[model samples]
Target: MDATVNACIGSDRLFDSPTTMNASVAIESEMKWISGMRPILSEEDFFTWMSLIIYVTLFVALIGIISNLLVIITCARIGFSETINISYLALGIADLMASATRFYGSIFLLFEITTTKVHFDPRTVSSVVAFLPSQGFEKTAAFITAFIALERCLCVQFPLHVKTIVTKRKTIFSNVIIYIFAFGPSNLIHMVYRFKWVYNATQNRTVLAIDQSETRLRYILARALYAYYGTILNFTALIVVWICTVYLVLGLKRKAVARKENFKTSFIKDNKQKDLQVIKTVFLLAVTYLVCSIPTAITLLVPQFVPEFGSTRALARISRVSYMISGLMMQVNSCTNFFIFLYMGSRFRKALITLFKRH
Candidate 1:
C-alpha cells in the first residue's frame, strides 16, 4: 500500500518540485501571488507525526509476523497430510517475509527522517531502499492471494484435477514466479541508475542522487514506464483473483443446491460444510484486500487528473491522508492474513490451538 501510494505521489512530486521551485521566483517578483497561496505545513510537525506513526505500526506488525511464523513452523513440523494446510504454510511464509520487509523499511525511513533532515530522493538509493521491497511484497501478496484463489477454484471446479495439479512442487514454482514478477522491474531500474551520496552544503545534510540523463523526457519516460508496468500487472492480478473467487462461490452454490435436491443427506452435509469454509475464507480475504487496496488505488488514480484537482489545497490534504491511511491498511493486510485464517478455518484454528498447548 505504501508502495502504491508512494509510487503515485513520488513520481509526480519529484516531477513537479523543480518546476514549482522555478515558478517561485516569478511569484516573488509579483506581489499578487501572495494573495492566493496557502500556508504550507511546517516540516518538523509533519516529520514528527509521520515518524511516530510509522515506527509504532512497524513494531506492532513485527510482533504479529513473529507469532504467525511460529504457528506456521509448528504446523509444518507436526505431521500434516492435508494439502490446503501446506498452502496455508506457504501463505504464512510469504506474509512473514512481507511483514519483515515492511518493518525494516519503516524503521529505515523513520531514521532517515530524524538523522538526515533530508527529503527522500526518489531517483536514488534511498528511493530504492524505501520503495522496492514494499512494491515487491505488495505484488507478492497479490500473487499469493491469486494462488489461493486458484486453489479454491480448483477444489470447486475440478476436484479430481486438483489432486494432481496443486502439489508442493507447483506451489514452489508459483512462489518463484511471484518473486520474479514482483522484483524484476525494480531491480532492473536500480541497475540502470547508480545512486551516489553527496553532502548538500546549503541544507547541511546528506542527499542521495542518481546518475541519470538530466533530460526531462528521460525522467518522464522512465516514470511512465514504471507506473504503467507496476500498476497494470498488480491491478490485473487483483482482478483475476476477484474473478476466480466469484467463480468459486457460484460453483459452491450450485453444488449445494444439487446436493440438497438429490436426497443425498450425508453428501449435502459434507459438501455444505466444505462450501461454507471456502466461502468464509475467500470472502474474508476479498474483504481484506478491498479494505486495504481501494484507498491506495483511489490515491493513485486521483493524481492522474492533476489538472482538475491539483490546485485545491483541500484535495491535496485529502490525498495525503488517503495515502497514509492506505499505507496503514496495506501493512494491516500484510500482518493480519494469518489471524484471518485462524478465525475462519477450523483446521488452522485447531492446529494453532494444539501447537500452543504443546508449547
Candidate 2:
C-alpha cells in the first residue's frame, strides 16, 4: 500500500493546479453536485456488497492484528533464550502493525467511498495513516525475515561463530536499525507534503493534492526510493533466503546419505522430517511475499506508461479496478502472515495455542 499511495499521488498528470482552471465555474459546479447528488444507498443493492466486503476485511484485519499481538507478547514472555526466536517476535510485531494500519485505513477508505463529501485530505491523511505505516511495517517485516535467514545461514555455515555472535542485544539493536531505515524516508515525505484540499472538477469534490512543486519533488523522490531501493532490497533478501533454504536442504540430504551409509537407521528418519518442515515454511514465506507484492510494484510503474494507454473509459475502469485489487492484495499481505506462522512455525503455533488457552 505504501508503494500504491506514492504512485497515485506522485503522478504529475493526476492533479494539476485547480487554481489554473476557472475557479468560479469549478466552485459553482461542485456546489451543484453537493446540493443534487443524493445518497444512493437506498436505491442501490451494490451498497450491501460494498458494506459486506468492507466489514469482513475490517473484522479479519482486526482479529489478525490482535492475534499477532498476543503471539508476540506470549513469545516475549515465554520463549526460550535464543536470538533466533527474537527474530520471530519482531516479525509478529511487524505483522501486527501492518494489520492494524490496514484495518483503520480501510475504514477511512470505506467512508470516502460511501460519502458525498470527501472527508479528509487524501494526500496528508493517506501519507500518515496509510503510506508511512505501511512502509514502516513492510520494511520491518522484510528486515526481520532477512535477519532470520542470515541467522539460519550462520548457524548452518558456522555454528560456533553463531553461538558466539548472535546475542539478544544484537538482535534488538538490529531491529531498531531496520525500523529506522525502513520508515525514515516515508515519514520524511509525509512531513514534507502536508495534505491540502483542492477543488476537483471531475469528481465535483474537494479532493487532496500536494499543491506545491517542492512537495511534489519530495513525493517523487520518496516513491522512487521505495520502488527501486527498498523493493529491490526485499527481493534480494528473498533470493538469499531461497538459496540458503536450498543449501540447508541439500546439506540435510547429504547428512541423511551419510547416516544411511553408516547404518544409523533412525538418524536419517527423524531429522529429515524437521528439515522438510523448515523447507516448507521458508518456501511458503517466499511465495507469500512475491504474491502480495508484485501487483503493487507493477502499479507503481503504471503511471509512467499510462500515457501510452491513452484516456478511454474502458482503460480508466481497468486502471481503477487494478488499483482496488492491488490495495486488497496489500490487505491480504497483512492478514496472511499470521496464517503462515500457524501453518509453518511450531513456536508460533504453540504460542498462539497457549494464548487461546489463557483467554
Please report the TM-score between candidate 1 and the true structure: 0.74
lDDT per residue (tens digit) for residues 1-359 in model 1: 22222222222222221101111122222222234555243334434545566676687668758866875775685444655666556666666765776666565555444443454343244344544555656666777777777778887777658779788777767767776776555455554456667664434677675654555754665565456434675577668777886887688777777656655688767866775686668667766776677766665566576633333432333334345456666677777777787777776677677877998
Which predicted model would earn the best TM-score?
1
lDDT per prediction?
A: 0.57, 0.56
Pairs in steric clash, model 1? none
TM-score of each: 0.74, 0.68
lDDT string, candidate 2, 1-359, tens digits: 22232122212332211101011222222223343343332213323443555576688678768777776776776675767567767777887887787677666546544443464544335445564466567666766766676666565566448667888898888988877776565455545455677765534677765554565676576556545333565556556656665666666565555545655567766754554565466556656765676765575456567752213322432343344445556556666766776877776677667777888
Q: Point out where model 1 deviates above 4 Å.
A: 1-35, 39-52, 78-83, 112-126, 200-225, 228-230, 261-275, 306-317
Q: In angstroms, how far off is 121's CA in candidate 2? A: 3.0
